[model samples]
Target: MNLTAESVAEALVVNVDEERIDAAVAIQFKDRMRDLTAGAGGRIILDLGRVIFVDSSGLGAIVSVMKFLAPAHRLELAGLTPNVGRVFHLTRMDSVFPIHADVAAALHGAGHDL
Candidate 1:
Protein backbone atom coordinates (compact mmCIF):
# COMPACT_ATOMS: atom_id res chain seq x y z
CA MET A 1 0.00 0.00 0.00
CA ASN A 2 1.83 3.08 -1.26
CA LEU A 3 0.21 6.14 0.28
CA THR A 4 1.08 9.81 0.03
CA ALA A 5 -0.02 11.93 2.96
CA GLU A 6 0.06 15.72 2.89
CA SER A 7 -1.32 18.47 5.03
CA VAL A 8 -3.68 20.71 3.11
CA ALA A 9 -5.35 23.58 4.92
CA GLU A 10 -7.27 22.17 7.88
CA ALA A 11 -7.03 18.56 6.74
CA LEU A 12 -4.37 15.98 6.27
CA VAL A 13 -5.01 14.42 2.88
CA VAL A 14 -3.81 10.87 2.42
CA ASN A 15 -3.89 9.62 -1.13
CA VAL A 16 -4.00 5.87 -1.63
CA ASP A 17 -1.83 4.79 -4.53
CA GLU A 18 -3.46 1.41 -5.07
CA GLU A 19 -6.44 0.50 -7.15
CA ARG A 20 -7.52 -2.40 -4.97
CA ILE A 21 -7.55 -3.12 -1.26
CA ASP A 22 -8.21 -6.80 -0.55
CA ALA A 23 -7.70 -9.28 2.25
CA ALA A 24 -4.05 -9.66 1.34
CA VAL A 25 -3.30 -6.00 2.01
CA ALA A 26 -5.97 -4.95 4.45
CA ILE A 27 -3.87 -5.26 7.58
CA GLN A 28 -0.90 -3.64 5.95
CA PHE A 29 -3.10 -0.83 4.82
CA LYS A 30 -4.42 -0.22 8.30
CA ASP A 31 -0.95 -0.26 9.81
CA ARG A 32 0.38 2.07 7.19
CA MET A 33 -2.50 4.44 7.73
CA ARG A 34 -1.77 4.59 11.41
CA ASP A 35 1.85 5.44 10.75
CA LEU A 36 0.98 8.03 8.13
CA THR A 37 -1.56 9.71 10.34
CA ALA A 38 0.44 9.59 13.52
CA GLY A 39 0.43 12.94 15.31
CA ALA A 40 -1.39 14.54 12.40
CA GLY A 41 -4.06 16.94 13.58
CA GLY A 42 -7.39 18.25 12.31
CA ARG A 43 -9.66 16.40 9.83
CA ILE A 44 -8.41 13.47 7.72
CA ILE A 45 -9.29 13.04 4.09
CA LEU A 46 -8.53 9.63 2.64
CA ASP A 47 -8.28 10.24 -1.07
CA LEU A 48 -9.39 7.06 -2.75
CA GLY A 49 -9.16 8.46 -6.24
CA ARG A 50 -7.28 5.44 -7.53
CA VAL A 51 -9.21 2.81 -5.64
CA ILE A 52 -11.35 0.85 -8.07
CA PHE A 53 -12.26 -2.01 -5.77
CA VAL A 54 -12.56 -2.85 -2.09
CA ASP A 55 -13.30 -6.16 -0.37
CA SER A 56 -14.85 -6.84 3.02
CA SER A 57 -11.47 -6.94 4.66
CA GLY A 58 -10.60 -3.72 2.95
CA LEU A 59 -13.74 -2.16 4.34
CA GLY A 60 -12.87 -3.36 7.79
CA ALA A 61 -9.37 -2.02 7.39
CA ILE A 62 -10.76 1.40 6.62
CA VAL A 63 -12.96 1.24 9.67
CA SER A 64 -9.96 0.26 11.73
CA VAL A 65 -8.11 3.34 10.57
CA MET A 66 -11.05 5.47 11.59
CA LYS A 67 -11.22 3.88 15.01
CA PHE A 68 -7.49 4.35 15.38
CA LEU A 69 -8.06 8.09 15.06
CA ALA A 70 -11.26 8.19 17.00
CA PRO A 71 -12.46 10.97 19.38
CA ALA A 72 -9.50 13.22 18.77
CA HIS A 73 -9.89 13.50 15.00
CA ARG A 74 -12.14 12.52 12.12
CA LEU A 75 -11.58 10.50 8.94
CA GLU A 76 -13.27 11.53 5.74
CA LEU A 77 -13.19 9.54 2.48
CA ALA A 78 -12.75 11.08 -0.91
CA GLY A 79 -12.64 10.23 -4.63
CA LEU A 80 -14.53 6.94 -4.59
CA THR A 81 -14.57 5.10 -7.89
CA PRO A 82 -17.97 3.77 -8.91
CA ASN A 83 -17.39 0.14 -7.91
CA VAL A 84 -15.49 1.07 -4.79
CA GLY A 85 -18.25 3.48 -3.83
CA ARG A 86 -20.81 0.69 -4.18
CA VAL A 87 -19.07 -1.40 -1.57
CA PHE A 88 -19.51 1.37 0.95
CA HIS A 89 -23.13 1.83 -0.04
CA LEU A 90 -24.00 -1.87 0.11
CA THR A 91 -22.25 -2.35 3.42
CA ARG A 92 -23.74 0.87 4.79
CA MET A 93 -20.29 2.16 5.65
CA ASP A 94 -20.87 5.31 3.67
CA SER A 95 -22.91 6.63 6.55
CA VAL A 96 -20.10 5.91 8.94
CA PHE A 97 -17.39 7.66 6.94
CA PRO A 98 -17.67 10.86 5.03
CA ILE A 99 -17.50 10.35 1.22
CA HIS A 100 -16.64 13.04 -1.28
CA ALA A 101 -16.73 13.15 -5.05
CA ASP A 102 -13.18 14.42 -5.39
CA VAL A 103 -10.11 15.46 -3.47
CA ALA A 104 -10.92 19.12 -3.85
CA ALA A 105 -14.32 18.65 -2.32
CA ALA A 106 -12.80 16.77 0.58
CA LEU A 107 -10.28 19.52 1.16
CA HIS A 108 -12.89 22.21 0.90
CA GLY A 109 -15.09 20.61 3.53
CA ALA A 110 -17.81 19.53 1.18
CA GLY A 111 -20.72 17.22 1.91
CA HIS A 112 -21.45 13.66 0.77
CA ASP A 113 -23.42 14.93 -2.18
CA LEU A 114 -21.76 12.46 -4.46
Candidate 2:
Protein backbone atom coordinates (compact mmCIF):
# COMPACT_ATOMS: atom_id res chain seq x y z
CA MET A 1 0.00 0.00 0.00
CA ASN A 2 2.91 2.26 -0.60
CA LEU A 3 1.30 4.93 -2.78
CA THR A 4 2.38 8.48 -3.31
CA ALA A 5 0.38 11.19 -5.03
CA GLU A 6 1.48 14.33 -6.82
CA SER A 7 -0.01 16.74 -9.27
CA VAL A 8 1.55 16.63 -12.71
CA ALA A 9 0.21 18.86 -15.45
CA GLU A 10 -3.54 18.25 -15.48
CA ALA A 11 -3.44 14.85 -13.79
CA LEU A 12 -2.90 13.54 -10.35
CA VAL A 13 -0.19 10.92 -10.60
CA VAL A 14 -0.34 8.20 -7.98
CA ASN A 15 2.63 5.91 -7.96
CA VAL A 16 2.31 2.40 -6.53
CA ASP A 17 5.55 1.80 -4.77
CA GLU A 18 4.92 -1.87 -4.06
CA GLU A 19 5.79 -5.01 -5.98
CA ARG A 20 2.46 -6.68 -5.38
CA ILE A 21 -1.12 -5.73 -4.61
CA ASP A 22 -2.71 -8.82 -3.11
CA ALA A 23 -5.44 -9.86 -0.71
CA ALA A 24 -3.49 -8.71 2.30
CA VAL A 25 -3.06 -5.19 1.02
CA ALA A 26 -6.27 -4.71 -0.92
CA ILE A 27 -8.14 -3.01 1.88
CA GLN A 28 -5.17 -0.92 2.79
CA PHE A 29 -4.71 0.00 -0.80
CA LYS A 30 -8.29 1.12 -1.22
CA ASP A 31 -8.27 3.05 2.01
CA ARG A 32 -4.99 4.72 1.19
CA MET A 33 -6.18 5.56 -2.29
CA ARG A 34 -9.27 7.18 -0.88
CA ASP A 35 -7.14 9.19 1.46
CA LEU A 36 -4.79 10.21 -1.27
CA THR A 37 -7.46 11.15 -3.76
CA ALA A 38 -9.81 12.91 -1.40
CA GLY A 39 -10.85 16.27 -2.86
CA ALA A 40 -8.55 15.79 -5.84
CA GLY A 41 -9.50 17.04 -9.27
CA GLY A 42 -8.90 16.02 -12.87
CA ARG A 43 -7.61 12.61 -14.02
CA ILE A 44 -6.06 10.13 -11.60
CA ILE A 45 -3.22 8.28 -13.23
CA LEU A 46 -2.27 5.23 -11.24
CA ASP A 47 1.32 4.41 -12.04
CA LEU A 48 1.86 0.68 -11.58
CA GLY A 49 5.32 0.47 -13.04
CA ARG A 50 6.74 -1.19 -9.95
CA VAL A 51 3.78 -3.45 -9.37
CA ILE A 52 4.49 -6.92 -10.75
CA PHE A 53 1.37 -8.65 -9.43
CA VAL A 54 -2.28 -7.89 -8.72
CA ASP A 55 -4.68 -10.45 -7.33
CA SER A 56 -8.47 -10.50 -7.66
CA SER A 57 -8.89 -8.45 -4.52
CA GLY A 58 -6.41 -5.94 -5.80
CA LEU A 59 -8.25 -5.64 -9.09
CA GLY A 60 -11.51 -5.27 -7.21
CA ALA A 61 -10.04 -2.52 -5.12
CA ILE A 62 -8.87 -0.74 -8.22
CA VAL A 63 -12.29 -1.02 -9.80
CA SER A 64 -13.87 0.20 -6.61
CA VAL A 65 -11.64 3.24 -6.72
CA MET A 66 -12.79 3.99 -10.23
CA LYS A 67 -16.39 3.71 -9.15
CA PHE A 68 -15.74 5.99 -6.26
CA LEU A 69 -14.25 8.58 -8.53
CA ALA A 70 -17.32 8.39 -10.71
CA PRO A 71 -18.05 10.92 -13.49
CA ALA A 72 -16.32 13.59 -11.47
CA HIS A 73 -12.86 12.17 -11.91
CA ARG A 74 -11.31 9.61 -14.21
CA LEU A 75 -9.05 6.81 -13.05
CA GLU A 76 -6.43 5.76 -15.58
CA LEU A 77 -3.67 3.19 -15.30
CA ALA A 78 -0.09 3.30 -16.47
CA GLY A 79 3.00 1.07 -16.63
CA LEU A 80 1.44 -2.34 -16.16
CA THR A 81 3.92 -5.19 -16.02
CA PRO A 82 3.38 -8.13 -18.36
CA ASN A 83 1.81 -10.34 -15.73
CA VAL A 84 -0.37 -7.60 -14.31
CA GLY A 85 -1.41 -6.49 -17.78
CA ARG A 86 -2.43 -10.06 -18.62
CA VAL A 87 -4.77 -10.18 -15.67
CA PHE A 88 -6.52 -7.03 -16.88
CA HIS A 89 -6.63 -8.30 -20.46
CA LEU A 90 -7.87 -11.78 -19.56
CA THR A 91 -10.53 -10.23 -17.39
CA ARG A 92 -11.33 -7.66 -20.06
CA MET A 93 -10.72 -4.92 -17.51
CA ASP A 94 -8.29 -3.36 -19.92
CA SER A 95 -11.24 -2.13 -21.92
CA VAL A 96 -12.78 -0.65 -18.84
CA PHE A 97 -9.75 1.48 -18.09
CA PRO A 98 -7.45 3.78 -20.01
CA ILE A 99 -4.11 2.00 -19.97
CA HIS A 100 -0.85 3.59 -21.02
CA ALA A 101 2.63 2.20 -21.47
CA ASP A 102 4.10 4.68 -19.02
CA VAL A 103 3.33 7.78 -17.02
CA ALA A 104 4.68 10.06 -19.70
CA ALA A 105 2.50 8.41 -22.32
CA ALA A 106 -0.51 8.76 -20.11
CA LEU A 107 0.13 12.44 -19.66
CA HIS A 108 0.68 12.88 -23.36
CA GLY A 109 -2.48 11.00 -24.18
CA ALA A 110 -4.40 13.26 -21.84
CA GLY A 111 -3.35 16.29 -23.89
CA HIS A 112 -0.65 17.44 -21.53
CA ASP A 113 2.07 19.55 -23.10
CA LEU A 114 4.75 17.31 -21.65
Candidate 3:
Protein backbone atom coordinates (compact mmCIF):
# COMPACT_ATOMS: atom_id res chain seq x y z
CA MET A 1 0.00 0.00 0.00
CA ASN A 2 2.88 2.33 -0.61
CA LEU A 3 0.96 4.65 -2.87
CA THR A 4 2.24 8.13 -3.59
CA ALA A 5 -0.12 10.76 -4.90
CA GLU A 6 0.92 13.79 -6.87
CA SER A 7 -0.66 16.33 -9.14
CA VAL A 8 0.59 16.20 -12.69
CA ALA A 9 -1.03 18.69 -15.02
CA GLU A 10 -4.76 18.45 -14.56
CA ALA A 11 -4.62 14.93 -13.17
CA LEU A 12 -3.87 13.25 -9.89
CA VAL A 13 -1.15 10.70 -10.46
CA VAL A 14 -1.00 7.82 -8.00
CA ASN A 15 2.11 5.73 -8.09
CA VAL A 16 1.80 2.22 -6.67
CA ASP A 17 5.12 1.41 -5.14
CA GLU A 18 4.35 -2.18 -4.38
CA GLU A 19 5.32 -5.20 -6.41
CA ARG A 20 1.97 -6.96 -6.04
CA ILE A 21 -1.66 -6.02 -5.66
CA ASP A 22 -3.27 -9.19 -4.35
CA ALA A 23 -6.02 -10.26 -1.92
CA ALA A 24 -3.99 -9.21 1.08
CA VAL A 25 -3.79 -5.61 -0.05
CA ALA A 26 -6.99 -5.18 -2.00
CA ILE A 27 -9.04 -3.62 0.75
CA GLN A 28 -6.19 -1.43 1.82
CA PHE A 29 -5.71 -0.40 -1.74
CA LYS A 30 -9.34 0.57 -2.12
CA ASP A 31 -9.43 2.43 1.15
CA ARG A 32 -6.20 4.21 0.43
CA MET A 33 -7.41 5.18 -3.01
CA ARG A 34 -10.59 6.57 -1.56
CA ASP A 35 -8.61 8.62 0.88
CA LEU A 36 -6.24 9.89 -1.74
CA THR A 37 -8.87 10.80 -4.26
CA ALA A 38 -11.45 12.25 -1.94
CA GLY A 39 -13.01 15.36 -3.41
CA ALA A 40 -10.51 15.32 -6.22
CA GLY A 41 -11.28 16.76 -9.61
CA GLY A 42 -10.47 15.85 -13.17
CA ARG A 43 -8.63 12.63 -14.03
CA ILE A 44 -6.93 10.22 -11.65
CA ILE A 45 -4.19 8.17 -13.22
CA LEU A 46 -2.92 5.04 -11.55
CA ASP A 47 0.71 4.34 -12.30
CA LEU A 48 1.04 0.61 -11.94
CA GLY A 49 4.48 0.35 -13.42
CA ARG A 50 5.91 -1.19 -10.26
CA VAL A 51 3.10 -3.64 -9.78
CA ILE A 52 4.08 -7.01 -11.20
CA PHE A 53 0.90 -8.89 -10.30
CA VAL A 54 -2.76 -8.16 -9.72
CA ASP A 55 -5.27 -10.71 -8.48
CA SER A 56 -9.02 -10.70 -9.03
CA SER A 57 -9.58 -8.99 -5.72
CA GLY A 58 -7.03 -6.38 -6.65
CA LEU A 59 -8.74 -5.75 -9.96
CA GLY A 60 -12.07 -5.48 -8.20
CA ALA A 61 -10.61 -2.93 -5.82
CA ILE A 62 -9.33 -0.94 -8.76
CA VAL A 63 -12.74 -1.06 -10.37
CA SER A 64 -14.23 0.19 -7.14
CA VAL A 65 -11.95 3.19 -7.30
CA MET A 66 -13.10 3.88 -10.84
CA LYS A 67 -16.69 3.64 -9.75
CA PHE A 68 -16.09 5.95 -6.83
CA LEU A 69 -14.64 8.57 -9.13
CA ALA A 70 -17.89 8.51 -11.15
CA PRO A 71 -19.69 11.48 -12.73
CA ALA A 72 -17.27 14.26 -11.90
CA HIS A 73 -13.96 12.52 -12.24
CA ARG A 74 -12.18 9.80 -14.22
CA LEU A 75 -9.83 6.96 -13.43
CA GLU A 76 -7.22 5.90 -15.94
CA LEU A 77 -4.58 3.18 -15.92
CA ALA A 78 -0.99 3.58 -16.96
CA GLY A 79 2.31 1.71 -16.75
CA LEU A 80 0.78 -1.76 -16.56
CA THR A 81 3.42 -4.43 -16.47
CA PRO A 82 3.21 -7.17 -19.10
CA ASN A 83 1.56 -9.68 -16.78
CA VAL A 84 -0.79 -7.12 -15.34
CA GLY A 85 -1.60 -5.84 -18.81
CA ARG A 86 -2.37 -9.40 -19.90
CA VAL A 87 -4.76 -9.82 -17.02
CA PHE A 88 -6.64 -6.68 -17.95
CA HIS A 89 -6.76 -7.72 -21.60
CA LEU A 90 -7.93 -11.22 -20.81
CA THR A 91 -10.56 -9.94 -18.45
CA ARG A 92 -11.57 -7.33 -20.99
CA MET A 93 -11.05 -4.64 -18.36
CA ASP A 94 -8.77 -3.04 -20.86
CA SER A 95 -11.80 -1.94 -22.83
CA VAL A 96 -13.44 -0.55 -19.72
CA PHE A 97 -10.52 1.70 -18.82
CA PRO A 98 -8.38 4.24 -20.54
CA ILE A 99 -5.17 2.25 -20.63
CA HIS A 100 -2.01 4.06 -21.54
CA ALA A 101 1.52 2.87 -22.17
CA ASP A 102 2.85 5.03 -19.37
CA VAL A 103 2.22 8.13 -17.29
CA ALA A 104 3.65 10.42 -19.95
CA ALA A 105 1.54 8.82 -22.63
CA ALA A 106 -1.52 9.15 -20.47
CA LEU A 107 -0.91 12.86 -20.00
CA HIS A 108 -0.30 13.31 -23.69
CA GLY A 109 -3.42 11.40 -24.61
CA ALA A 110 -5.50 13.69 -22.45
CA GLY A 111 -3.72 16.79 -23.73
CA HIS A 112 -2.78 17.61 -20.19
CA ASP A 113 0.11 19.90 -19.35
CA LEU A 114 3.16 17.67 -19.44
Q: Name the top TM-score candidate.
A: 1
Per-candidate local distance difference test:
0.90, 0.90, 0.88
Error of 1 at 88 (Å): 0.4
Model 3 Cα RMSD, Å?
Answer: 2.9
Per-model tally of clashing residue pairs: 0, 0, 0
RMSD of each: 0.9, 2.8, 2.9
**Model 3 pairs in collision:** none
Q: Tens digits of per-residue lDDT for model 2 on 44-73?
A: 999999999998989999999999998898
> Candidates 1 and 3: which is better by lDDT?
1
lDDT winner, 2 or 3: 2
Q: What TM-score does each of the candidates earn? A: 0.96, 0.94, 0.93
Q: Candidate 3, which ten residues in sequence have the lowest lDDT sum?
A: 105-114
Query: Which residue window of length 10 is worst by lDDT in model 2?
Result: 105-114
Ranking by TM-score: 1, 2, 3
Off by over 4 Å in 1: none
**Candidates by lDDT, descending order:** 2, 1, 3
Q: In model 3, how many backbone clashes occur? A: 0
What tens-digit string does per-residue lDDT give for candidate 1 at 55-94? 9999999999899899897788988999999999999999
